[model samples]
Target: MPFVDLETNLPASRFSEDFLKKLASTTAAALGKPVDRMVVLVKPDLPLFIFGSSAPCVVLSVAGIGVTDTAEKNRDNSATIFPFLTKELGLSEDRIVIRFSPLEPWQVGKNGTVVTFL
Candidate 1:
């Protein structure tokens, strides 16, 4: 399975299903995998702060928003994501870093209530 998770400091409306489907297709083609076998998650948050000069590096802390996790696919999805965001959302590639995490289902809770992964 080729799983892609997108975390951005933008509006969720910026990512539509059609855009995601196309992204999935592109990702599958890049990875030489089937589209049906791919999964993607889109998360939108506030903007990011990047450091360094050339090859601008992103500053990460224990407390940060927009994090994603993938499983059993290409390791460099950021390469694909950046272009997609630029073309689709009109975002700039500079000072942007799309970090990846290995995917694992977890029992989540909010407002003192456990939520279902399903």
Candidate 2:
């Protein structure tokens, strides 16, 4: 599974499920994975404080089996994710932070069992 958990301090805007769907599709294409397996969680309007200042900031974590397997792949993923944050979320690229966690199938769980077994 390709799972993205995105948390933003910025207040919610006119975001809809359509935006998430689009993001999933973009992620799937970038990772060369099936679009139907993408899962994105967006949490906005959260009270986030950094450097004693209240500004628009986003912290996103992406975890999957093979998405972040290599440096080159990470670069490829960022190329697609960064621009979308600026254009769709209105956050400056610098204010956005993305962390990639590449998981082995056994490290993930699914339906009360390990993903690898499935």
Candidate 3:
């Protein structure tokens, strides 16, 4: 299954319907699956770090979010992130792994402080 985890400084509102549609189209094409068969999960992770490896590598880990409850959804979510990871960041998709952690606000904490937008 394709899996994608995105950690961006951008706000959730920025992910408009048009963007989702485009993402669905692109992801379906990449995965060789129907658009409806794909699943996508978008999370807003502010104050995050997107680091680079020694030789153009990318690793994304997202916490405190949940997407659809299906393997296809997970795969589609992962596939959707490839374009941005490759084009925007100049990193190969093969080097990246997107994982979703269905975590509660209280469960994910940094320095004993639970970070939440609510």
Q: Provide the overall lDDT of each model, using Cα atoms, as 2-decimal numbers.
A: 0.53, 0.83, 0.53
Please give each candidate's TM-score: 0.54, 0.88, 0.42
**lDDT (tens digit, per residue) of candidate 1 on 10-51:** 666766889789877866665566778666676666454455
The local distance difference test score of model 1 is: 0.53
Pick out the ten consecutive residues of candidate 1 with the lowest summed lDDT. 58-67
Which parts of model 2 have CA positions greater than 4 angstroms off? 50-53
Using TM-score as the measure, the top candidate is 2
lDDT by residue (3-99, candidate 2, tens digit) is: 9888887656745888888888877887888989888888889887654556888887888897788899999999998888788887788788889
Give the better candidate number (1 or 3) by TM-score: 1
Ranking by TM-score: 2, 1, 3
Per-residue error at 82 for model 1, in Å?
Answer: 3.7
Ranking by lDDT: 2, 3, 1
Clashing pairs in 2: none
